[model samples]
Target: MSLHEVHKSHRVGWLRAAVLGANDGIVSTASLIIGVAAAGAAKDNILLAGVAGLVAGAMSMAAGEYVSVSSQSDTERADLAIEKKSLEENIEFEIDELTQIYEERGLEPNLAKEVAKQLMAYDALGAHARDEIGISQTAGARPVQAALYSAGTFTIGAALPLVVAWAIPGDHLIKTVAASSLVFLALLGGLAARAGGASIAIGAIRVTFWGALAMALTAGVGRAFGVVA
Candidate 1:
């Protein structure tokens, strides 16, 4: 019989970006709409604000993810370059380092040394990158991928509340937007948690909590300013 195992670690990079983008999209757009509505803004103005927020938030998420992940990618390249040079100049030292690393992870000294030699012989830089520097192809940063994932997810997330605000009419716009947005946030959290193999309830609660807080604070500020004006 053959055995198959599944792991979620490989999803770390894109998953993080997707979840963050979607969560921010829903929260920010919804909150902005709610705040503007609370301040006695007209329906047209509220919808316009929501549209503006969606565009701005999506672009911000893309740019932010790209810049941050690019930095990570740069650092990784630098580390790999340095490791490559060290391997060329100090091949023996590299092997000994790999051997010691394996030994620390519970291999016998001789066996570790032999395994290190075999691996280095096959792919010296690869061996050092994986075992010595803790960077692997599976989890290496990809700036373009991160940027796309974040921007795409953010647009989708932001569109949900924006659509709700557009569809509903006056007198109940604020309540409807707030309620629908919270539900959207909870759903997003649960989906993200399930995708990442985490507790659905916990994920849903955390996102909704922060989202609710953001909307509440924004609404209060808008209401106060509306009263003052």
Candidate 2:
């Protein structure tokens, strides 16, 4: 089988978080460095800035992911609680709710009622969880996992520019950082597109174009300020 048949597309859920984290890490850190370097910062000072950005960005990603996913989890819990209470108090109405849901999905009246009855009889809560509450195996809330994936991917992506800066000597650190970051961004875009089963060329071009623009703007700002300072 081809790579596409290797597994179900459900894995794309987690992969999305990792890709987003890495993309943000690369773009933000690279732009910050380019801007600062163009502003005529010393190599040592640029290194310091890059290091600081990496740490700060990773932590911020982790905290943000955790908080956002936690909110989703809270809402999901509240939904489940209400579903349980409704199932216990109004079994008939709950079945009717399920039947209506199926009918809305294009089932005939009799078929909708039969399907709802069978599904509810088999597992009442699972039916509501999947249909009404939008909680399924593919997309569920896991705050800690999301936080860790985001933090880890961000750190890895941010390290690319840092490593390039460290490898290249002297004032050319700015050029090296920008070049390496653009290359990395292209790769990231292609990889994300591959996973999402889209046009890799389009994704690469779009990501690189945006990243280049960001760097250009930052560099322009830095140069404008550098001349003044």
Candidate 3:
């Protein structure tokens, strides 16, 4: 017998949070370091800025993920509540709703009704939640899980530039950080795309373009201010 295959959609929650957190960490931290270096800041100051960005970005990502996922969880709970109440008050109507849904999905009317009856018999709430409201256990929101994943990934990505800064000479700091960050962003994009079964080239290009733009803009601002200061 062939083994059952796991689908990528199952990882949607953590994958999205991790990718966003990591991309933000790399772009923002690298931008900060490049900006400071452009401004002729001391090497020690640049490292400090990168470290600070890592800490702040991780916390921000965590809070943002928590609030956003919590709101989604609230909506899901509200929907489930409504579904539950409808089932308790008028099961027949709810069954008809499910039947129609299956009918709309190409099942014949009689077959749809039969399937709906069986599903509702087995687990009415589970059927309604899955078919009617589009909530599945795999795709359900988990606020705490999302928050921790985002924060942890952000720290990992942000630390790359900091480590590079520590290992390199001050004279080559800005270029080194910018180049290395682009590579990191590209790799991250490719990996994320691969995980999602998307085109790696497209993902890499998209991330690299944005990373380069962020660093360029920050460096320009830093240089302009450096000259002024």
Candidate 4:
């Protein structure tokens, strides 16, 4: 039997980022719409807020993820460049370093050196990058890709609350938005948990709890401010 299972997908991190962005988009935007609407804003006004929220949130996620990931990409590029230069200038030194590294991991000195020499002969920079610098070609960051992914997922998440807003009549808007938002959060949580091989029930419960708190707090604030206004 397997001691433990790790889903080794290169795309898992991307999926995780997308899911996190979507979850934030849904919970925050829904709360915003509910709060503004509960303040007795007109239907058109509510729709306007929701639409603006969706667009702004999507763009924000895209830009933020892009900038952040771009920094990481830049650092990675620099590191790879340095590694390549070192490999070209001091090939023997790098080989010896890799051998020493393997030896330190409890392998016999001669065997470790042999393994290192073989691996380095095939792909010198790749071996050092993976073992020493802890970066892999398979998991390099992509700024534009991350940006698009975050934006797309955020829009998808934003649409859920927008639908609830449209489908419910004026009188039942509050009830509908509250109930539907929780359901949406739950589904998203479950799907994300499944993907990460975690407990769906825990994920669903945690997401819904936070979503409910956000909605309730917003409702309270809206009603309070509505009275004051």
Candidate 5:
């Protein structure tokens, strides 16, 4: 029989993108809807704004993730190229470097060299990439995956307030969305923290606080402008 073990580090890539996308989608869209509704916008106009926000935010998240991750991927490729050239030109030096890395990690000198030799024999490029260049196959960047995750998550998060707005009457839209969005945000925070192996309470409180601040600031601005104008 074979057994498999899962670790939280494996979720680092997509989880981060997902959580960020969902958080932004919920907070930004909800804040926008609440602000516009508070400013006495018509029901149709408010819904239109929410729809527009959802589309724009999703695309923005995708593009941002793609560009950022692509940059990181590019740097990783460049470093790999450098490391590869170094290995090809001077195998001894590369082995020596690997030996030193293992030594620093607390292995004895002769054992470190032997272990490095065995690892190199198994997969020279992989060992060098993992230890010297700090790039691992598990942590490799995938721009497409990141972009898709972010965009999809953003759409899901942004839809919550929109759904609430559509279901409720105009007179109650602002309050309904405010309450519902806060609850939604708290839930998202807790879920994200749990997935990332973090404290649920801290995550929930942190996201809820920021979400409240964003909505409050936007609402204040809308109310002030509505009254003044």
Candidate 6:
């Protein structure tokens, strides 16, 4: 017989970037549309704002994710380099360190030392990196992956409200956009939660709440400015 198990841990990197990008896309673009519409802007002007926001926000997300994840990757590489040097200079010490770590995790001393020795003999740097430094290939940072996921998801998310606004350019544009955007946000939250294995209702509610707040605040500001103008 054979046994297998599925894991979600590997999805953390790209999943986080995708969710953040999509959420920001829907929220910011929706808010911009609602605000501009509330301020008595024409349909073309409102959509133009949304288009501009989508472009700027997508670029911003891509650049930001790339830079941040690249920094993490750099740090990880630096740490690995140092660990490699340490292993070369003091191989025995490295083995003992791995043994101690295994012992701390409930293995007997003799067995721990044996296991560490075999593992280090097989791949010293890899053993230390995994057990001592907690870096692994599955969870390691990838700057290009994060950047592409963020930019792609942001564009998809931002397009939802933009499409809605374009479709219904009438007196009820504000109501339609706001309502539909909330629905889109709730769906996004639910899907993201499902993908991340979290409570769907909670995720949906939290995302919707923040999105509503953002749209409301922006709308209020737009209305105030409209009144003044």
Please, what is the TM-score per model?
Answer: 0.96, 0.92, 0.96, 0.90, 0.95, 0.95
lDDT (Cα) of model 4? 0.87
| Global Cα lDDT for candidate 2 | 0.87
User: In candidate 2, residue 103 scores what lDDT?
Assistant: 95
Write the residue-wise lDDT of candidate 6 on 1-229 in tens digits. 5596777788999999999999999999999999998898888999999999999999999999999999999999999999999988998999899999999999999999999999988999999889999999988999999999999999999999999999995698989999999999999999989998899999999999999999999999899997436
Cα lDDT of model 5 by residue, 158-195, tens digit: 99999999999998998899899999999999998999
lDDT of 3: 0.94
- Once fitted onto the true fold, the runs of candidate 1 whose alpha carbons sit more than 4 angstroms away are 227-229
Q: Candidate 6 versus the native: TM-score?
A: 0.95
Worst 10 residues of 5 by lDDT: 220-229
State the C-alpha lDDT per candidate. 0.93, 0.87, 0.94, 0.87, 0.93, 0.94
RMSD of 4: 2.8
lDDT of 3 by residue, 95-148 (tens): 899999999999999999999999999999999999999999999999999999
TM-score of 5: 0.95
Better of 1 and 3 by lDDT: 3
Residue 113 alpha-carbon offset, candidate 4, angstroms: 1.4
User: Where does model 4 exceed 4 Å of error?
Assistant: 1-6, 227-229
Quote the positional error of residue 19 for candidate 6 in Å: 1.0
